[model samples]
Target chain A: MLGLSKKDTTFLLVVIFLTLATPILLQPFPESSALAQFNAGYPDLMQRFAIFGIFAIGFNILFGLTGYLSFGHAAFLGVGSYSVVWMYKLLNYNVVPGLVLAIIMSGLFALFIGYISLRRSGIYFSILTLAFAQMSFNLAYSVLTPLTNGETGLQVYNNDPQVLMSEGSPTSPHFFGIVMNEATKVDVGGWQFTFSNGYYFCAIIAIIVFYLSLRIFRSPFGIMLRAIKTNQTRMNYTGLNPRPYTLAAFVISGMYAGLAGGLLAAMDPLAGAERMQWTASGEVVLMTILGGAGTLMGPVLGAGFIKYFENIFSKINDNILHSWFSALPDGLEDFVVFVFHPFIGKGWNLTLGLLFMLVVIFLPGGLIEGGTRIWNAITGKNRKKKREDAAHHPKPTSHVN
Target chain B: MGILEVSNVNKRFGGLQALGNVNLDIAKGTVHAIIGPNGAGKSTLLNCLIGKLIPDTGTVMFNGISVLGRKPYEINQLGISRVFQTPEIFGNLTVFENMLIPCFAKRDGSFRMHALESIAAERDIIEKAEHMLAEVNMSDKRHMTASSLSRGDKRRLEMAMCLVQEPKLLLLDEPTAGMARADTNNTIDLLNQIHDSREITMVIIEHDMHVVFSLAKRITVLAQGTPLVEDTPDNIKGHPKVKEAYLGEAAA
Candidate 1:
């Protein structure tokens, strides 16, 4: 955390190695190892982890650093998604153009919103962003029909004149004269893994974005934003008007959101206005807060966690659970089904709500706290250094300490 | 030539006239203290100087440039830094990281936007920050998280943060408001050490008479949002008007 020293970086790399390698090692286990389902190994889910991880990380840059609680960040994400899809429809299917569109559009949107919302502080800022996002959502669904395609969403079908895929060719709008229609699947001895080239392509972008966020988190500007969150008045009195610094943070985060949204659209060449809906924005906020607001890897972990639950829970029904538990004792099977009842079927949201509540109430800092707790538990340095650190700095509860 | 000038400055906040036609001039390298009672517009004056508040009718000149309508970061870029009564710092950051901000501001101006390169890699800034920390006797606490510092140390760190910018003017409000006598003495000594050693122009707004008299080269007393008198510590302590307007029963 101290500008990430070489030694500190070494420690971080070790953690990353452990997390990434864990899923590969889980391949040998039974299809349902207690932890196998949560390992984030599947290609579709893994790709999502990277994209939404980028989304939540970008959100954290604004919400976590500047202490601005945004309920409409998803609008930027949805806009990015729409722009990328439109790019694929009109231009070549190369990801670069989509990425650029996402950043530019997201940045433009953030600048507009930040200019107005940053005028007020506390709850007013949150609601202003929410209002702007709602405005975007309403326009995308109706007013911006030509671009956003109303409620039907934007998708690539070889319609009219804008088909770059060359009449009956299987390659969906080739990238730079090279068509990447080849889908590769690798099975490490019966785990049944399928990976589209798009997933890894997005995976690398997510990693780069993740690393960039880490750098921003530790920079001088990051510190200034955090300070602004803690005490804008004091900062202003200290001869530092927080507006410009916060505005910088807001724009950077907006660009990140745009990038994530753009990547999502590029992967599938379909953009729905629903993606820009307020609910989608709320989902990213959920992911960020559930994972850990200010911590680096928390957003990634939270994104992975939420996506995994969405995939697994959305498909599982009472019959599927009953069929699996049919072999158990009559009483035990009924009890098991009953336990998963409120959270198993259309109750995925109930589960999410419970998880959010638990994380918020017990661990307000999110997964970051859990990680630090684990690290502290293992190192046994907590008790000794606790007093010392406490003695050293007053640590006013103004912001993200 | 006057390095920093404020002429005919007036500030009104709704119903209150916080500063009434006030004018101030701070020479290049002098310790200028602004002393007033609880509601004498001490903070209002500092706020106007830093562009946190726009004066109703006035002009602020810093380094021969107009500072009347500049942003706080822009004013800071003009080499005017400020420290608060309560320690204003980045709690999550280390003591060392807190000092790098002004270096970037001073060298790179208000908007550096340097996305790459670790802040620690800025060796020149680090060296200078280290020097400032040593000046405040806080070099040993470099690696400590700023959130973990004692009250006295937080003030020292805040002082060093302002100093590292090498500002022509440093504005401090209540630098020793809530400190114990020992800590206050420590703060006074630290301010003295910097005043004796550095080429900084400081304007301090303090409630504590001991801190004000100890460090101020010249002190300005404000009563009812107007400058009561400007004099040396000896002259201020004995002046009937200052004592009557400030130090009488209420100053006790």
Candidate 2:
């Protein structure tokens, strides 16, 4: 079963199926219709979904298993993007070198940060990581302007020497002859499907990273990380130093973030200091938590959910809201649109925050736990009994700890 | 020479001396108990011995190796294990997983990368953990989360976790500190069985006289951060100075 346990193989297969079918699944609305704005099958948004999914999945490996909440993961992501851009400038427009350099550079950066941050646990650890990230962001924005291009960001320019690329080749990132931004469009009876090479590239990497994360979640190393989360004192007395284990998990996650950052650059060919901001880091945290931090599929779902809202729901305006309520009386429709105005369109973050609060207050385990509970209730099974049964007979590939 | 030797140990906390001129020689293959009234530095001494605290001036030698400046995990690698006052099992992990941790430590040394190796495939370690669980009579509850176990069972699991490492020296800080009489007796029996069947040495800090007399071959009574008396359980039971410092009354 692909060198993984049966359950893991199944999970991977399901993810593959869903990822390949994303274009059809996301573009449910017919083109040129009023609801066409809801179509997430567009190349740019689809690429974002897969990229952020990688970011959130990596984050889960750290915060979920080790219980070390890092507020600076986006620093690694930024470093990764910056590294890939440098690779493009010095080497070539080939994504392979750029991505490889991104992962390596971010992994090294993470190693340095994790070494210092892991000396403290809990809130102090979070604060240390945040401070480091903030420091990196500030530096990249100002003092490191030559490297990061300051506020303008780092991007490929025509004057740069691309040693590996011959003259007259496309400047945009490509894998061999296939341009990343190139899309193949298919027209059905009423629906249109866009199959983007960039989206597929990001999707394949995301799935591979997800599978690696699945392996890590079931590995003995993962168990040790969970043990550290459970009781570090016990781990210490058991003759295991938790620092190395935590550091390893941190670096691995940072590399994943770097991969995501590389994919972002491969798609758009730009790197911004703003991507290293604390807000970006918090978004990944939110994605992991909103999905289910420790669950296998949770982070990806959360990433898609957040990205979907950010790209689609935020596009709604007062006119769109009024159109939905147009059937009502004029005055009532105005009032209804006004009441719902602050939660949609430019106020999508408000809705996200409220949803986050609800999940934290009621579903501490996040959306996956909520879904599991609903499933249990629908099946008429006792939740507690099911949990106990799961504890007793844990699935081979599903080691949440 | 004793397996563990502590000499001229001194520990201070600001204005107060927590331990002063403390010296102990614990022979191999014996259960030694250190008892004292509250604040007599019982735990402080245990901490110093287990590398949790660095004595101001002392030498702690275990199997002829100095343990004063080493980390706790390093000390544990030197074949010493400590059971805390409260059970310190990994509450989020299953009881069986809790037991396997020490086995991993023993086999893998302080640290090794065993990430890709599945626990199910590690037949030797799993067998050892399961057998240890069977010995502790916790095989049936091995699947339960460690936190869900009763206080007594947690202590048992903690002890099992330590024993599976086959540590040269076992340090217990009140092994049965908060347990019913029945559980206390059961713990005593378990300790007695372990002591009889293995060549391991144990150092226990306890306030309960019954547990001390039942398991300890030699006892040290501390008073005011110093040893008041050191003798066999029978001799210390009626000693006048021990009564004055610990019992606070003449023996009936």
Candidate 3:
């Protein structure tokens, strides 16, 4: 079963099926309906979802298994994007070399950062990683303007030497002869579904990365990482070095972020310094935690949830709210829209923050735990005891003995 | 020559001397106990031996290898396993998973990348872990999380974790520190059985006299920051120096 156990193989299959069917599933609203505005099946948004999903999945490998919460993972993402754009500038529009260079460069960056950051654990480790990322972000913004192109971002110019580019090939990123942005729209009845080449490409890579993550989670290396999370002292005393294992996990996770960043650049041939900002890093963390940090499907779900809300929720204006409540009394509808004003439209981030807090407070295991709880309740199983035990043991606490 | 040899070890914390000019030789395949009152440098000496703390001026030789500046994991790879005063099992993992960790370390050295191999396919390691759990009478609780176990059971699991490595030297720091009398006796019996069945050596630091006499063949008593006496358990039982150091009685 692809080197996975029976249960893991089944889980991977379900993930593959769902990812492949995302465009169809996400476009349930008919084109004529008002809810159609909420649909997320558009090519641009779908590509963003898949790319961020890859980022969240990679972050989970470190934070979920080893309990090493890296606060600077976005630096790798930015580095990856820069590498891909550079590849486009120097090589060709083909994404293979760009992606390969992105992964290699980010892996080396992760190795250097991980080597230094892993010397400390807990919050200090987080601070060290954050500092490194901030330094990178600042450097890319100002000092390394020639390399990163300062505020304008790094992109392929018309005059740049692309040695590998054939004379008649498209200047934009492509997979051989197929342009990444090419999309096909099929209209059935009132429903319109968009199938984008870029989204499909990102989705396929995301599925492969997700499957590899499943293998890593079930492997002996995954067990060792969990062991390090639970009791690092015991790990050391048990004849295992936690440092090298943690460093490896960190590097692998960084490569995942780099792959995501490369995919983003492939879809849009630009690399922004803002992508390396701490806020971008925080978004991935929020996604992983909101969806469930340790669980396999949590991060991707979290990524989709956040991205979907960012697209749909931000579109809600007072006028749209009024239109939805038009059937109600005029005064009541006005009051209703006023009441909802702070949580919708430009305030969508406020709504997201509130939801994130609720998840952290009530459902510490993220959305996955909430789903499990509901399932257990419906099945009439007394899972309270088990849930209590898990809550009692939260994350591993450090102690000197 | 003994399996572990410590000589002229001195350690200080600020103005207070934690360990002063300590020397010891632990013979192979024997149970040696190091006992002392509160703050008598018993733990400091143990720390020095296990690479947790480096003595100011001393030499620690394990199987003739100088263990001066080695990391804890490196020291563990040299076949010396230490059980902490508090049970330090992987709380988030199952008892069976906890057992498999040490077995893997023993088989695959300190670190190996097996990220794609399934645990179920490792038939030999799984069987070995299960057998070790049965020996510790924890086979029924193998699937239970380590943190959910009772205190005494956690101690047993920790012992099983250390034993799975099959180390040359086993260090126990207060193995029965907070156990009931019955549990203490059970631990003593378990230690005695393990000692009789294997060629392993043990050095335990304990406050329990009953545990000290039951399992320790050789005893080293420390007072202040240095070893006061080293002798057999019987000779150490009623030594006048030990009584005075313990009871603060003036020598008569």
Which candidate leads the pack in DockQ?
3
The residue-by-residue lDDT of candidate 3 on A1-401, one tens digit each, is 88887887888888888888888999999999999998898999999999999999999999999999999999999999999999999999999899999999999999999999999998999899999999999999999999999999999888999998887988789988788999899998999999988989999999999988988988889999999888989999998989889999999999999999999999999999999999999899999999998889999989999998999999999999999999999889999999999999999999999999898888888898889889898986866676766754445332110
Candidate 2 lDDT for residue A252: 92
Candidate 2 deviant stretches above 4 angstroms: A32-34, A383-401, B249-252
Best by lDDT: 3
What DockQ do you compute for every candidate structure?
Answer: 0.35, 0.56, 0.71
Instruction: Give the per-residue lDDT digits (tens) of candidate 2, residues A1-401.
Output: 65587877887898999998999999999997988888999999999999999999999999989889999999999998998899899988889888999999999999999999999998899999999999999999999999999999999887898888887777798887679999999999789999999999999998888888887877678888889888999899999999899999999999999999888899988999999999998899899988988788888889998999998889999999988889999999999999999999889999889998888777777889889889988998886676666644533221222
**Residue B244 error, candidate 1, Å:** 3.1
TM-score, chain A, per candidate? 0.87, 0.95, 0.95
* Candidate structures ordered by TM-score, highest first: 3, 2, 1
lDDT ranking, best first? 3, 2, 1
TM-score to native of every candidate shown: 0.87, 0.95, 0.96
Displacement of the residue A196 alpha carbon in candidate 2, Å:
0.8
How does residue A176 of candidate 1 score in lDDT? 57
Across B22-97, the per-residue lDDT of candidate 3 in tens digits comes to 9999999999999999999999899999998889998999999998899998999999999888899999899899
Per-residue alpha-carbon lDDT of model 1 for A1-401, expressed as tens digits?
Answer: 53577875775676455445433632444455543444455656666877888888899898887888887887888889888787777765766777788899899989989988899877888898889888888999999999888899887765624545555444453345433334455656546454555555666677567767778866667766777766565455345557778788888888999998887776567777777778888888888888888777787778877887887676678887888789899999999999998897688888888988888777777867877888898989677877765655443332222
Candidate 1 scores an iRMS of: 3.7
Q: Which ten residues in a row have the lowest lDDT in candidate 2 chain B?
A: B243-252
The weakest ten consecutive residues by lDDT in model 2 chain A span A392-401
